[model samples]
Target: MVAVIKSSASIKNVLQYNENKLKQNVAQLIHSGNYGKDTEQLGFTDKIRTLEKLISLNERTKLNAVHISLNFDPSEKLDKETLQKIADTYMRSIGFGNQPYLVYQHHDAGHPHLHVVTTNIQRDGKRIKMQNIGRNQSEKARKEIEKEFKLVQAEAHHLKQAYEIKPVNIQKVQYGKSDTRRAITNVLDVILPTYKYASLPELNAVLKQYNIVADRGKEGSQLYNSKGLMYRILNDKGEKIGIPIKASQIYNKPTLKFLQQKFLQNQTEKQRHKLRIKNAIDFSFVKRPEQSLQELINALQKERIQLVLRQNDKGIIYGLTYIDHQTKCVFNGSDLGKPYSANQIQERCNQQMQRHEQKLTQRPAFKHANEQKQSALTTAEENGITFKIPGVKEVFKELIQTEQEGSLAAELRNDELRRKRRKKLHH
Candidate 1:
């Protein structure tokens, strides 16, 4: 199964663009929370549109929107089109079309999945209740979809059981392996219902609170109480779900602390990477080669691109152009600070333009434009507009004369009617 979540606030715009077909196939209202009577009475279209609008609003206010869609795997006999039809029918069963919602099948990404777009708002213009409603509804919907599709309940068996493993140490213990395992086991069984510990330390704390001691082996003066040892935690089904392992195994094998530190470090690296991307677009101090703002905008527009300006800590403006969805190239905006020499500015502009043109050539649009031009020429000839051939000239001339006569006749009738009106008034 695959899942997708999206939230949007542009219900009207999205529906109107698609001709409102989304609101027509809704089967039923599964659940509505917090909006009271107004939401309860909303039809499928209104409900969907309202929710979509709310999602958009939520994105604007919270800088995030959440949507989730899931589908079952198809059997061997079913092809892609069959799988999509099944997904669509399942969506309809869940009231997808009756409300203002969008459901899309994405088969490009390995597995077949559905993309559901919904609003976070109700008919009364209030935000959906956030009391874990999303999680709860998703779980409920998943089960129903699975049941409706008659999908096999894929097994949750653990491959770790195939190996005979021994506990390293009971003392110098972090959380007792057995109890930590049981706690995790219970969590997986859905007994706890809230398992938010994404890190080893947090998991360690939970195990400790449950009176579970976690211990690791020691070597010389070094205690092997690293984060790698925290992998013993199991859910009620005895599945190794919330386990953390270290990258290094033989040489200086990972401990629980090392694993935790690595996870945190990796998270920090990811954050830094995202920040760098954002800064490239918004930082002011990043120097652009030396083009004026107008010149930069013109260059980007010529290349079918958009420029994003960012202010840096030094109060300098930096301009970065988004070349595509996944790539951005930076330019120097320092010319905004002081008057630049004509030679320096001209050289910078030329360099920037060269880079931008080179980037554009690498884009899909370059090839797509060529194909489109070729197709347009073919179409023109098929319609007799490309009549450079000797034999087709007579046919083209006759067609043009017919068109001109039709136009002249329409004009003459208008003029004669106007003259008749003028003479009637005089009489």
Candidate 2:
């Protein structure tokens, strides 16, 4: 089994995410730890009030909410009772057994998994220290639980792959075939906390890649003036389809105002990856000095860096965002440096394009000029006259269309073709 823990400032947001899953019928309340009522008996308000009461006890404890996912091998078909037992034991081992928490069996993946939502605040109003809890307590608990239950070990599991936190498989998300709002919400659940994008467009830059987008509508429109944001899914053609889900309706209420706060915070948090992105772009150019813009984009992609070039309807690029999948960071090109700005990168691409076009246009003309000269020399040679010009004669000597050279060339060509055919056959 594999375990992952995430801390959030709002238990409400954490609870809402899971409950929303339950409402969609894709998740279930398997076990409610330390709650007065059973998993099926407890209501949403009851669950929220019970956890928030302790959190309210400590005013300074902002990050009290904990979201933990326990993943099992896809081949392990554990029943509800077994899953409950394992979850309870894992919680007790990790010191969260006594806390008011909810365990949900999520059926959104290829494997069996449980999402536990709880608060770290103790009943006595003291906040439980969560720093390194995942690396320390959770790690210890996971290994023991695996051994105690005789389950498949994550390191040496039969599947040869460990289940971890992964973004939704966008390719499988078809509109009407799957739950639309739930799919979009699941995307937010992963992306909002994972990627550091400061603004709406920056956030959309990451979201759109997953076939989701956050829109504030046109300027001065009702939704825009009200500072409202809606997340909509895009089709294969990148057109918005189906109904749009309001940002307020999603987990954590990722409203325009909420994003403004993230913008300030991410502006600083995303700085640590600047040098990494710059080095990637610099190395791409150094690898091949004469590569075109598309080639440059492809090279960066090989390094897990995505260069997003945004253009207007007129086909003029207006913005650039570099998404580094390796670091899980996104940055507007202007934020990196002037050299990486849209205008400057466009300038570079334009120069490379011009050079490429020059090569294409000039090559055939040069070849044709040589062919004309060669033809004139061949005609003179066939008339029984020596074709000679001062410096030009020596330059054209090897290229002369002589009978002997033609037979020798044919033999060499036949030899090359034979070698190619033999190589193909051998392969």
Candidate 3:
């Protein structure tokens, strides 16, 4: 079992997240603690009002909402009773036993997980201390609960491939419809926090998978200068079709300023994942050498890493971005190191092209030489002439040298040019 906890300033957003899922029939309210009525017995306003009352106890506490998820291994087939018990045990162990909280069982993914929503503000108008709650208290509680329930230990189990949320069907999100906005929100909510994307375009790559894209109008537009960003739903053909929603207006506040902050934070946070990504790229090349840029993209896709190659208007490749879903990190190729940088990758691709061309150039020459030799032998047999089959060892050596000289020289010149380019890139 694993626990993911985050504190939110708004309780309504967290509650609405689960409530929307419940409306979709993908989640069910399992246990309602401190609330006099169960979720189904109360309306939406009542649910929010009840949680709001608890949050209102401490007006000074800005970050009052605590949203957490307890994720179990897919191998564990836990029923509702077992899940509820785990939630209750986890809450009480983390010093929230007496707090007002609600547990919802979410079956949206392959694994069984529960989303728990509560307020840090207690009934006594005092805020609960949440500093290092996950690292210090929650980790201890997780281990104990796993041992107590004989649950599958997270350390002992290797999680299966990640399950990404399915893209929304384009036909369902008609223009000027609420479903379009809701569909876009559902995708963004799941993707924005989960995936590690550094820039707006990198984030859009993942968003495009869900028929959504982020736009900044045009290059010199007023919106672009202000760093304003908007999310638009796309059709099946990837053309924009719906009304664009400003980034600031979104529930999660995925504004340009917000994303820019995350970009800087990710720079430091993603260092630990550098080696893992490097090894994955190395393994990819070992499995399939001489891969073009497109082929490399295809290979990395199988590893659940998106390779975004940036090119100039002249079609020269200049930048590379690696988005690793497994580690949930984003890295520029150069950020990882020089070997993984854009220029180095282009050099590798050039080497592939050279090797392939060399092979193509050699095959025909060898085939033609063999054909000449066969013709000579046939003539000697048919004419009844006594002709010695001369050993052309020295001749063949000279032929190979002559045939390879130009290709080898070209390869040498290319390597020299690449070295110069790398030097410039470093400068």
The residue-by-residue lDDT of candidate 1 on 351-397, one tens digit each, is: 76687768755555454554555565567678878667787857755
lDDT of 2 at 334: 94
Candidate 1 segments whose C-alpha is farther than 4 A from its true place: 2-64, 74-98, 130-135, 154-427
Ranking by TM-score: 2, 3, 1
Look at candidate 1 and tell me the lDDT of residue 330.
Answer: 22
In candidate 2, which residue ranges exceed 4 Å CA deviation?
2-10, 16-28, 34-46, 58-64, 79-82, 88-98, 107-110, 122-175, 349-427
lDDT of 2 by residue, 132-213 (tens): 5777898899899889888888787454454433344445554256667777866776677667887788888888887888
Model 3 bad stretches (over 4 Å): 1-7, 16-31, 34-64, 68-86, 90-99, 104-115, 119-163, 175-178, 219-222, 225-227, 286-289, 310-318, 359-427
Number of residue pairs clashing in candidate 1, backbone atoms closer than 3 angstroms, sequence gap of 3 or more or interchain = 59
lDDT of each: 0.41, 0.81, 0.78
Best by TM-score: 2
Q: Candidate 3, residues 121-178: lDDT per residue as tens digits?
A: 8888888898668778899999999999888776663642233356877766673435
Measured by lDDT, the strongest candidate is 2
